[model samples]
Target: MRCSWLLLLPLLAACNSTPSAVNEGTVSRVADRQGRDTTTALPAPDTAATKAVSAVSDTLRVARERHNFSHAEGPSDLFRLVFRGPSILEGNAEFTITSPEGQVIFREMLTEPDLEAALVYEMKTPTATRAERETFVLRRIDRFFLPAQFHTPALDAKAGFPTDIANLERPTWDDLRKRPDAIGFEYLKGKEDRQRIAWSPLKKQVVRVQ
Candidate 1:
């Protein structure tokens, strides 16, 4: 009777283990299918946020390339020289002045590219005297001075003096109009020189010698 029970016990254990193994295999297959379906159902990624960030970056880049300068009220006799331009994304710049008497009065080198980049030089000479003849020179002190890269030329051809114009000849309105690069300079000739000179690119008008 004991031998017969031992053989029966082995068959009973086999029957119990086979059902659990089969159930476990079926559960694993169902879980794997559900996981795959969940992965497939996920929505596609949106690109709107990426595009917005790109557009903002382009606007900032364009703004950085633009530069301007102006002079307002100051000392009555002294003339104030104001220079403003885009800070180079890379590299440096130097500003210098050569007096009418062939003297180097002032010089400064700017290495801070993160700043707006401007220079102000005040001279003791009467505005009337210095107004007669003054030369301001801006030189690029960096190795890579590609005007096109910065999108702002080192010298604004329109606002800067022309190299071809002889010092003896006074630039006329017609002459300036012909050269788009010539910057209009207004000065008092006798009594009428107090009037301001204006140039509007948008309006396509040049009020010379105002």
Candidate 2:
């Protein structure tokens, strides 16, 4: 009887152990499957914002490149003046000359290659009666600078008069006297005589008496 009881106890214990083992196995398999599903179900990383920023940056770069290319291909005329000197005494100057008919004849700025520089400008005039009057106008335009001022007498003297006066047609001085707009000069000065020179609508060579 004792042996029979022992055998029954062993069978009962086995029955209980079998159910626990099955439950544990089922729970472990379910947990592993759930972990795999969780990993697989995650959405892929989104790169929309990064891609958008990169696109914008690329667009800006392309626009700048186009702008640089267009500027390089644009039409342009370059005029440059270089000055070498110590301290300039006179300031820079600029001037504009207008005809009696209010036409812009000449405009220029003058700067010293070195010391005190100035701009001298002469405009086409209608005609003048007395050359002195023309000289006065020129003087006024030059701001009455003794050095920069040039009168018809000075011009005549310089050209040796009657000899080099090519376009010597007597102008309608009366009209110029009434209008005084035949020829004119303008000088721009800063503090003294240093200034930059700018010329617009530059005419062909007038006198070549260098």
Candidate 3:
């Protein structure tokens, strides 16, 4: 009977020393058995919200694709570059003049309404550097623009250009001086805004408008 009691005592000791099924090891009750947060589960996707996001994304993508940033023309080096377009997309316009010898004469960003007034083709002094005054002929002139809508005439076979437009002749320097805008003390007063003549003395290019 004493040997059986000793065996039972050994069995009770073994049961007390064994690890428990409800382990208090490094884990929290707030987390599940898989270690995911019980309180912060991802909600089911809303179909309406997904459609709204998709629609906005498509709209922005199409707008980016449909944008036309380059639309302008220019003349040869002997003639001045004439750029005329609707004023709406004129903001943030860039004008680049490449030389015949594969050099960039000038690349300017102009926000003004008129390109002639915005840029000075010739240098004030003869001792200026190449960047200030390039002698190379204007090989190419490129104009770029930001995205904006412009109204223009629709192209059609029956739509012909109007022939009633009058021919314009270039005015002389003497004719420019006779104008009221170029009259007495206008240049000294810093009010050359209304000057009808824009001439490049070095390039021998002159443009006058009434």
Candidate 4:
């Protein structure tokens, strides 16, 4: 028994003295060999990686502010990144807003005027009084309706007026004619409505005039 006890003493001491190392994230630690653990942390990120991360964060912040959407409340699919010809921004691009399920909510030619109207329409809330309440549906029509395409200029000129636009309670066709570049149309659903008209010289699509 005494001899067996003597043999186990060295093994026990070896076990107690053995060195072990642990690494986690930026830290590396060595234990036991020197009777204490030593730790080292990884170096800071390089300038390029820091800049890349900051730029991406800034882009996301700008997009959310532009759409008036919040990362905490709204879905992540609010915006679609699209690349189009320069004309698209020169009041010549067409766009469609669809529901998450692919249901068409609105479609129209994006004109400079339409952008302003849409902004006003989105920013204001309807009031109880009819006199104070303004439905920018006519101003934001491009958000909802899609125009029909045509071949020749003559046919394009004669596509008439859209029934949806004609059905509006106010703002006659003559009022719309003043803004010749405005070509988007108004829409009315159960509890929602939108109206817009703009004429774009570059637009080949025609809206039937009633």
Each model's total of backbone clashes: 4, 20, 0, 21
Backbone clash pairs in model 2 (N, Cα, C under 3 Å; residues 3+ apart or in different chains), count = 20
Displacement of residue 180 (Cα, Å) in model 2 is 16
Predicted candidate 4 versus true structure: per-residue lDDT over 143-171, tens digit per residue: 33223321112123334445565433223
List candidate 2 segments past 4 Å from native: 1-91, 112-150, 157-210
- lDDT scores for all predictions? 0.32, 0.30, 0.30, 0.36
Cα misplacement distance, residue 10 of candidate 3 (Å): 62
**Candidate with more favorable, higher lDDT: 1 or 3:** 1
TM-score per prediction, in order, is 0.19, 0.21, 0.17, 0.23
Top-TM-score candidate index: 4
Per-residue lDDT of candidate 1, residues 1-210 (tens digit)? 999999899889875774453454432222364465221233456876774333222111111111121111221111122234442343333333333334433344444331222112233454423222212122222211223322112223455443443321235433444544433232221222222333333334333233
lDDT of 1 at 99: 30
Writing each residue's lDDT as its tens digit, candidate 2 over 81-180 gives 2222232222333333333334443345544321122222232455434453434333433333333332222122222323343433223222222321
Tell me how far the alpha carbon of residue 162 in candidate 3 is from the true structure, in angstroms, after superposition. 42
Q: Estimate the TM-score for candidate 2.
A: 0.21
